[model samples]
Target: MSSPKSGGAGWLVLLALLVLVLAVASVLVGASDVSMLALLGIGGAPADPMASQLLFASRVPRTVALILSGMAMAVAGMIMQMLARNRFVEPSTAGTVESASLGVLAVALFAPELPLFGKMVVSAGFALAGSLLFLAILRRIPQRSSLIVPLVGLVLGGVISAVTTFFAHRHDMLQSLHAWSTGDFSAVLRGRYELLWIGFGLTLLAWHTAHRFTVAGMGRDFSANLGLRHGRMVALGLLIVATVTAVVVVTSGMVPFLGLIVPNLVSLMLGDNVRRAVPWVGLLGAAFVLACDIAGRLLLHPYEVPIGTVVGIVGSALFLFLLLRTRARVG
Candidate 1:
């Protein structure tokens, strides 16, 4: 049998190859027919200027958004799970995404002239506040069953979502907010998706602080015993999670369980050592979302399904499986 380290390295390589394949396939599979041979110069340039334009402008940006958004949300989920000590907790469940959506709606209604960057900043700020609020609530709750934490988060998130919806309706921006909240890459283009690079940067920051997060995951007393500043680490982790969540939500909208499912799946296969698992989580997250997006594009041929819808269907099933598996272990 392969050693754990070797096995992880093997999976990393395999996942990297898979991501590359999917990325290329994503570029090729679109409304316009841009063949691999043409892209490779084997058959010269694309048949039409429109094909080249579409390839460079639409497909490439959309693919990059998928990769960045997937990896960021997955890493953000891992950070949240570590901090909450609950496998089911993630940005979507914990009110972060809903808060960001509210921020966007507020900006659209109150400050209609705000630029895209300004809107993103406002959304990220709200996300940070919402995440901090969730953490405070978690701190107040007495240690109980593991399931309680996520339940509370879900309730909190639902409340936030309702508030957002109410305001959106009042402002006559319900359809706009709904479109922004539903994850889809069909509208992605060169200028629109540049914000997601912030998520990429934050993901790298998360990796750098992986060991700190692992220490922080062991609860306050354990982190303190080792001379770690427990509060500071948790703050930093939440900042990373909030920033990534906001950026992804602002750019690509919500991709449901990209975070919740990816990190748990990575932990189930690889050990839960944050440092060891984070890179794999990122790679697998990107690949999984890319696969889902491709499936969404092809599922209805001319009419594409939203990536969020595809992920929601698959993620809900995986979440149920994880819940049952955890219950069995506890029993």
Candidate 2:
């Protein structure tokens, strides 16, 4: 049998390959027949001008958004899990998504003409506040049981989501809220997805802080004993998670399971060395989201299923399995 270290390296390589394949497949699978052969110069120019236009204008942006958003959300999930010391905690569960949604709605209602960048800033601020609130609640809770943290987060998220919904209905912007909350990359065009690149930067920041986050995960007393500033690390980790979640929710809507499922899956395969696991988390995140986006594009053919819906289905199933397995172990 391969040693665990070698196995992890092998898995990382496999995940990188899969991400590359899926990226190409995503670029090639759109409605217009953009000949990959032509793009590669293996054949004559694309027969239709629209083909090149579609490829560069729409397909490229959408694919880039997928990769960036996927990696960002996965990394965010990893950070949240580490900080909370709970496998099931994610942005959606922790109220960050709902908080961002509320921010977007607030922008639309009060300053309908606000630029997209302005909207993103507002949303990110709200997400940071909501995440801090979740963290505060976690601090008060006894950590005797791992599941209680996520359960509390879920309840908090639900309450926030309900409040957003109520205000959206009152303001007669429920449809707009729904559209922004649903994750779909079909509408991503050249300029619309540039915000997601900010997410890419945040993911890199997470990588730099990975060691601090891992130490912070060992509980406050332990981290403090090791001469680490536990509170500062936790604050930084939550900021990364909130910012990433806000950008993604603003750009592509709430991709529910990408964050929650990918990091946990990576942790199961590889051990909890955050520095080492970050790369695998990022690669698997990109591959998983790309795969879901491709499936969404093809599943209905002429009409596309939203990427959020596709991921929600798969993520929910995997989540259930994880819960059951955890329960069995506990029992």
Candidate 3:
């Protein structure tokens, strides 16, 4: 009963509404209260100079990083899902976060004076290695069951995280690794978050190469039949996912479910067709991050919970509910 034009229009309208909400929420949120009217430049000067500075220096960068990191993770999730042929294969779920965090801890502990870019490069290398390890494991374990794949990934991530935690504890760097592992956005001041630009670039590259990704996802035999080099596509996808995860981990810490949840939501709405889903996945990711960041900023008012905390709590609940509901429907 609905034409494609009508459906697209409806989605656009809903997306526009969400965008407005996120914009208002982002501008009006922080540890210090900034009124909507004042934020829109329709009121007197803010009462506190530090508060204004915090909004400018801290909140803006965090918001920008949130947007960039969310899109990057979401796209990474999509690419991983396509390559692994599993809905739940995300960087966080697949040991990328733990491996990157370990890399960061190594830098913080032993090479403390290394530049930020150097840290990102090291973290990205480890993340790429972790993902490749996961892919190798996937090949070794037959994928006759869909549920087993993500379960293996989750176990692998758990093992890596345990190792990282042990190292952190041994070096008395537990607090530092804990802070980095929790996906906190509170510390993202202007100079601190330029690393997230790497994520932005990776997301853009994903968008540009989306069509090839679709072909690549159709299994090696089918892609080769169509004259596409499956190996090249797989390599490119892993590189994109790894670079984005490293930048996000360094900039915003370890956000768990953004990558896993956003792509599935988009594919549900837009079908399995990767090209149509890519843009919507990005928009949804940005919106979700903005909304969660705003909620974290506002939930405690003067004492904000970290964006990572808010996302983890809310995102885990959402993912579990969706999983149960899907099971129920299937049953």
Best by TM-score: 1
* Per-prediction backbone clash count: 0, 0, 0
Report lDDT (CA) for all predictions: 0.87, 0.87, 0.81
Q: For residues 1-331, could you state the per-residue lDDT of candidate 3 as single tens digits?
A: 4433333756755775786678667866654666644454455654555556767787677777777777778888999988888887788878888888888988898899999899888898989899999988998985345667777888998999999999889988888888888888887889989878877788888888888888888889999999999999999999888888888888778888888888888777767877777767877888888888788777778777887888888778877876676668767
lDDT of 1: 0.87
lDDT of 2 by residue, 114-172 (tens): 99899999999999999999988878886447667778888998999999999999988
60-130 in candidate 1: lDDT tens per residue? Answer: 99999999998999999999999988999999888898988888888888898998889888888899899
RMSD of each: 1.9, 2.1, 2.7
Ranking by TM-score: 1, 2, 3
Model 2's TM-score against the true structure: 0.94
Alpha carbon lDDT at 82, candidate 1: 92
- Candidate 1: the clashing residue pairs are none
